[model samples]
Target chain A: MIKKRFILNFPPDSGDKPFSYHLVKDYDIRINILKAEVYPGKRGSLLLELQGKKDNIEKGVEYLNKQNIICESLDKRIHFKEEKCIDCGNCTAVCFAGSLTMNRDSWKLEFDKEKCVVCELCIPACPLHLFEIDFR
Target chain B: MQKTKTYEEINLKLKSGKAVILTAEEVAKMALECSPEDILEKVDVVTTATFGAMCSSGAIINFGHASPPIRMEKIRLNGVPCYEGLAAVDSYIGATACDPDNPSYGGAHVIQDLLEGKDVLLEAWGKGTDCYPRKHIRTKINISTINEFTLFNPRNAYQNYNVAVNSTKKMIHTYMGTLLPNLRNATYSTSGELSPLLNDPGFRTIGLGTRIFLGGTQGFVVWPGTQFNTSKPKNEYGIPVSNSATIAVMGNLKEMSPEYLQAAYYDKYGVSLFVGIGIPIPILDVEMARRVSVNNSQIETSVLDYGTEGTPKLGQVTYSELQSGTIKIGGQKIRTAPVSSLSKARKIAGELKKWLQNGDFEITKPVQMFPKNTSLKSLKETEADND
Candidate 1:
């Protein structure tokens, strides 16, 4: 059970209520609105918990981008280095889920679009800091 | 079977232009969601001591670096960079060989040791002086007889050799007999004396003049008891019958029991009897090995007291001498002595020091190094190609 928390911010009275309403109705997500009485002179905050497939969650994030939520973020980030990588199959071999691969007759490494769970198991194998996860 | 897909087929978007930053918790969660295959598409390299797979040796492996990285990653999902030098060196070699972009550097800890004045064969033994008490006892018997004639006898003769001699002898041994006991008896006693006592063997034997020695036995007892309460009884009411406990407690009381007590002392003032257990030999060996390896030197045979019973004494051989194989311990030249000796050990130290210097030599070469900067354009082009 992987759980992630994200803080999404919106402009005050941007008329984005319809978008929020549509997301909750379509995606079956739970949302809580912060009451103005508890937090004086503050714009409303909506707490959301979305449970489903990772790809779907990503799609929801993309939807937020489409909805123009500027300060949208997940608790983690996936990082990679461009210069140090050699398309070696070592990381692929270590990855149990078959997340990494090497191009035939070439020194290029490849990652599966749908199969990656972002475990960062390959980060230590790459001594040049080619792979990393930023949870801050 | 799915034909082994080329790196390009995995993903084109992850060409190394952008950075992905995720917290440890987030990474773990993401890892759980995606399969290893899915992860391969986003990044060109993977690094960790533990690969999350069960079959692997669990040692850290570095894929992209030419030389071992200064800092190695830990076997954890927390995303903290833990450093394990030896594992890092080995893993760097493993990863470089597989990756085309990075060139391999042959592993070189042994070479490093040579630079630090360590001999290869004798390198296993550490450098230090140790003294241990060695006791030996022997018993022998001789018999003589004299004959005298009385007044009634016509001829009197004094026969010393020809007369019959009746002799009865009894020997009572102490340490090796009652206190230490022979190999079989020792084992039987330590383990429960069951029908198949042979199956679970213990001590070898206790010889004559073998009193409880201080250094080896006492040192072993103190650390473990302090850390985990291994040999000590569960409570103050419980008494320790084993010799190991008695020796450790008494030794500490004489030498530095106060130091150990001060370190573990709690702020609350109260009169309480603390029962502690002593550390085991193997555990001490492992910790010593780790410490020695980190220090970039091997331990000497003398430190471990190869021949002596239970004390640390000055060793005859110096670190340089043992590397050349002049000193011998336990029938073999002291190649790598553990930390337990290094003091009071003599003949073994000389042989060990000589062997170490002879075997301590090394050389190094650069295989392949990482490129300076790989642009996103190149990465995209590489990913587009099937080959």
Candidate 2:
């Protein structure tokens, strides 16, 4: 269950290539498109979530690289200051993705990074000065 | 009138033995285990609490006159204008007041800066008169240097509030925080069943001079809150669905902590303070205990259309429904979120409960019961002189 977010860049002159189709048929990988702004003979950008075996995921990335597509991993990251978080469950509401949630048993906030879209909705939702977003 | 226990008897029970105390969150389970009469007889006190986005919250400071004694008129703390309507050195920095120079860092942040023990730039101007010499002053002042500091809030607790959402196609920012267009999200602010006023719906035990837990320290209720409206629709529980009675509270600023008091900012919604408050309700009788046992499913609030100027009710919902993480509106199950923090409120209630059991806290007798027949009046309907 190797999963990662990617920012794929397509050059304006990169010929008509079914970039996503090739990855699935050739490398046996799964691609979930988060966002895309691409067209024929136009520079394209795609935000994608890829899931597959570790070696197959690597092979898929190499395939995209040879196609003149810059496949950069988008580590859209957020950190919770454990001491500051009140665990009031405000984040769980604004978060469209279930990445941020409350553990019903402990009532403690459980943040699943795998499901986060980096929407930054939790930043303002928190009453306490917790949930800091750092994107590099 | 219904039978009720006096505040003295409960205090005696607390002092003589381990008082059967329960946090606001624990009341539901406690009720299921024992009858209301049985629980009421044994339970000395039920602690109610809330931590929410209270925009009208802030502190009043009286800075003893500086050398030459300038009669300060206009005042700004960290570029945020504070109300200097009181005599010379007195002013109030409200939570919603924004910084004139820098829009982002507002009065709420200034209050936070002071709580963090940081020196804030104090700038003021005045016209020198016969009694006062200096005209203007600019200096750094921290919480310690101030002569008197009081957290005087006109409306500390709102009995019930609306859950906000934007139904319009365009996004809108409001004091309720950013409301996404087309009902992408809904944000509600209230401690629900754990709120002090909710536990005592009819204002039975809450009134003037009632000792409370303010920012982890003991404080008092000064008077009925501004916009205290007793005239509103109520349910079987006697809890008003509309914005009902409010309370005016005062606490020592120096004795407060940053943990309970904080500054907050919404992307485009503006600044406000997170004030932690807890009030203890003595189970005077079975009736009082029944009131404290009010559940979230029984208490209700409205989801409002924030895209409009004045609040308009779009739908009616309960705290249980809101806390369930989803709410249905316009044939869609939209995600529901709370602007208030129940976790923080529970913490405050638990802390007060400990203070009560340890004999560190004392419950004060209400000087007077809150008014019941008052109607909310507008400013235009009043005059300073006796009409």
Candidate 3:
């Protein structure tokens, strides 16, 4: 099974459409909506995770595109500023997804974006305030 | 006869580039394979290090005299207020003192910025007097322009600290870290076996005037720290089970590096300074070897409930369990995290070892040894009944 994350930006008019219901129904893909901000007549965005066969996941993105929703991959959604970070593993306490962790061998802080679900837990968890959201 | 060494002997070897040094972690690992006597003979010094938030820290700066020589009564560095009761141009900028407009930027940030060679806006006000006429002055200053930049910390490198956890339904922000609700995770802030005081639990080697690695440069232990409580109960390994002894250190802030000094900001808490400190313990005897060899599994600390008002103790866990990433509290598995940087602690220990191996740093016999019994007295609103 393959997993993918994306931030779906819905146009102002299509905010009422049920993107999760349609993606799961038509594309046979599993959806985990990490974050959502949908309101009728207002442009909204969603930070979500999709899982299933690779083809089904791609079809889900296509389905989102067909509905006037601009789907963007969430590869570098969070920035880990290494220079500012003291490598204090405080962020890992709130990051339940195991994305922020200490490399046991090197004892340094390591961020695995693949494991991060964009929970934004590390933003406030960092004492240095080094983590930032990069939607652009 | 028992094999022993002294500060002079260690310094002689250090100066000749023949001193055998190992990090506290390395010596701890070596103790598992070799006997204490063998290890003591081979290793002359064991460097212990820690890099963590130390709030009772500040810098003393003498901003030279003004044009007309004002007895400055008030001072602010980059808009952050500093203590102004000292000499005319001398003042102390505490780490936690924040800017009125921005809480994140503080005196610690100002210190690090100055060390980075960046200019800081200095503003001062003085009461017009006969001896000192000038009233007000504002100017840009850097490290080179200042007279003395000394990092004098009231407390740093805690011997041990409590593990913080939240027991309430809502999340809490503390100096320890952000704690999730219902005791979901635990946060600790120490380097375990690689800590300075832990290796020298008896205060035999670390004392006033002892040379140390402070902010990437050599410094000295000035006095026993503010809450220097050496009277705390010890565990089976002779190490304190809770926050115990502490040391007051000072160094030339101008000679320090930004890598070893940093400013920290907590979510709801305030500003603090992350200080890098390392102390090398000379292997004086076989007993000293045994103390330096204590490992994480043997070092224990209490988990306290931060959700409550008094911070009641919940349970005890070892650093090995905390470093394992998960610990059990009352049969429930709770995730464990650290506020201290073990990697940076290791780097400091390695750096101190390099200083010794290269003959750049030498051991100093403490001018005075700390007293063994120190009561951590509590303050009261009213006087105690003596009757």
Model 3, span B322-360: residue lDDT tens:
899898998989999999899999999999999999999
Deviation (Å) of B275 in candidate 2: 0.8
A8-44: candidate 2 lDDT, tens digit per residue: 7889987578978988998888999876776767677
Q: Which residue runs does candidate 3 get wrong by more than 4 Å?
A: A18-28, A52-67, A134-136, B383-387
Give the top-scoring candidate (lDDT): 3
Q: Candidate 1: where is the Cα deviation over 4 Å?
A: A1-76, B1-387
**Per-model DockQ:** 0.01, 0.44, 0.84
- Candidate order by DockQ, highest to lowest? 3, 2, 1
- Which of candidates 2 and 3 reaches a greater DockQ? 3
Choose the strongest candidate by TM-score. Answer: 3
lDDT tens digits by residue: candidate 1, B221-324: 11111111123221121211121211112232222121111101101111111111111111012221121111101111122221224423323232333323
Error of 2 at A58 (Å): 4.1
Candidates ranked, most accurate by TM-score first = 3, 2, 1
